[model samples]
Target: MKNLYEKRIDQTKQILAPLGEIHTRPQFGGYGVLADNVMFGLFLQDELYLRATAQIEEVFHHHQMTRLRYIRRGLPLTLSYFQLTDAGWQDPTLFLQLATLALNGARQERAEKQNRERLKGLPNIGGYLESLLLDAGISNQEQLKAQGAKACYLKLDTDDIPLSIKVLYALEGAITGYHEAALPAEKRDELRSWYETRHPTATTKYRR
Candidate 1:
């Protein structure tokens, strides 16, 4: 079954070779062709489909070409695939356009997938920092400066806890801090003292 699929994939590449450079590799269930490392199309059961993007999607609509669906109840999938309109494979220009559209669509799809994956991996911060940042709409450092550190921290009780965690978060914010506001090395050192005080045991273990 695998060998048969490989043969069909090879044939699909051959059919597309004349149009331009076509790269074939195993993907999803069957085979995909990429132009410039961006997926332009795919082959399944020896049929070719091109990616569809917002701008050129209407071209696919006019011809009533089938939109490829990957996952149910997930993102909507669109592609520019068509069976040969005629017996001889006559429309070279149309083929090229469809292939280009597919490639662009695939690039967008891959980018969105990466963004979704990254958002899922955000670290958890305690309620104190979370509420401060959230209330200020400062999910990241860019927003941090606009809100100002002193104001942001005003709500939290500073006297009760050792200063280390606060300093560490500040240092982290400095390293990633946006263009508008960034903590200096001295401020980071002050935070470092808190870290040393709070995590002396753990710090010693790592130092060894």
Candidate 2:
């Protein structure tokens, strides 16, 4: 296996040299091909694979490129990397296009990972808020970002959980990844405006 891989690595480097500085390293039981610090291709199971994204997925599908399927932890898995089509392999210009699209997808994936990491560390958003978000069909930081603070707050209100002003600020805090009280004045005003619109004359009642 090692002997075969050394030859493939040399050939891949030569093929990609015209594009720019290409680097290869081992990861996930395969060798990754990187250009300008972004991995855009891979070698696995004696096949050359390229990263793919929705923007250029149709081109891959049109070529009928086989998707990489493997088994990990006894579970069948599929990755976005697809085998290089014969035409793309033969055409350096087309291969560069594919590699560019793949790098865009990699960057997006990296940004999403950072967002999820930030969400997990949110100060006031915990299991309770997560459940409320789930009930509101707004799971994950991506969804929370898309729905905006006001929309998520109103979605939770429909669940009849006896919420109040604190919950509004909490949603804003979750989106900001800070404690509820730490929100900026402009953001707090936006949340308060939305809350006042919904509850015109409600007073904060402890109901003790």
Candidate 3:
């Protein structure tokens, strides 16, 4: 098994070395390469493959490379994986295109990771409600009022927020908390009191 793994790693290195530095590491019981600390591709059993995104899937299709598939429950599970054609590996331009796609995918993955990490540090409802408000174009209390409660409630409904008045109060609390200074003192206090009344223990607890 070790010799097989080493052979696969060596083959991957030989193929990718010319393009740029390829950093090999074990992942998912196979080997993956990180180009510039961003996973660009993988090697499985001496077969080299690049990461496939929606944008690059077409390129892989054009080159007649088979989409990677695995059997699950006696059914083929085919997703975004694409086998690099022999011509694609030899053609520097095509190799670069694949590399570019991988890099973009890595950037997006990293950004999402960072967002998740940031959310991990925040109160559960903080980011979620902020995102909801941002999606509704209600960055401040003034904007929320401009939209009116019905419009805001409708938008919240579209987002699957419950129609109950209690949920509306929670939503209002979230909005006010995020835009404290923008909200009137009385409205902010009212929302805070409503929230505390609903969940008295939440007043001092930081459950994230």
Candidate 4:
């Protein structure tokens, strides 16, 4: 026997099937209704809610949709999803149109999220080095590029963090998107010379 939630999921999937490949996955204490692998709607307590992006928020408002909210630890947390009103459920065409808007919003959000490049995603950058860079005021890839490898190394050096020629090579590799060991011989030699000049007795490799 299908439970109410499961039955509702089937119904929602049927209504949203026109948009393409409708499916549900466990999420946020309920099920997330996705169209073509993009999350655009949510199901909670047998109720449906559409994702409300900024541009389509006014449209949701026009339909008198209620935003999802729940109390946790005595604090109310309101989510960005708006309840799919009775009118939407009663009218298949309107429901599909609203769902299409939700799908577009979800795609835009995904695209924007993918555009946010992360420094840790770069070559030769691990959690420890990323933390050191963050402490030295370099956060994202854009900030890392702006600081450059040499300037970033100098910042770490000033912080009295035990760093070596390898650390410099690593930073350079990260900036240039190359493996640290694959740095050019000339670049390696150049960095080694710079390090020796800066610290005559420092021989420990980057704090691993």
Q: Who wins the TM-score comparison?
A: 4
Candidate 4 ranges beyond 4 A from true positions: 1-3, 117-208
* Candidate 1 lDDT tens digits, 68-154: 654312223322444323322346566555565656666665566444422112333444545434322234444444544433333
Count backbone overlaps in model 3: 0
lDDT to native, each model: 0.49, 0.67, 0.54, 0.78
Per-residue alpha-carbon lDDT of candidate 2 for residues 18-135, written as tens digits (9 for 90 to 100): 6578897764467778877767788876678887765767878877788877653233545567898768767867776666677777666555654464444556777777755643
- Best-fitting candidate, measured by lDDT? 4
Candidate 2 off by > 4 Å: 1-4, 107-208
TM-score of 2: 0.50
- Give the clash count for each candidate: 5, 0, 0, 0
Worst 10 residues of 1 by lDDT: 154-163
What would the TM-scores of all predictions be? Answer: 0.40, 0.50, 0.44, 0.55
Model 2 lDDT, full chain set: 0.67
- The predicted structure with the larger lDDT, 3 or 4, is 4
- Candidate 2, clashing residue pairs? none
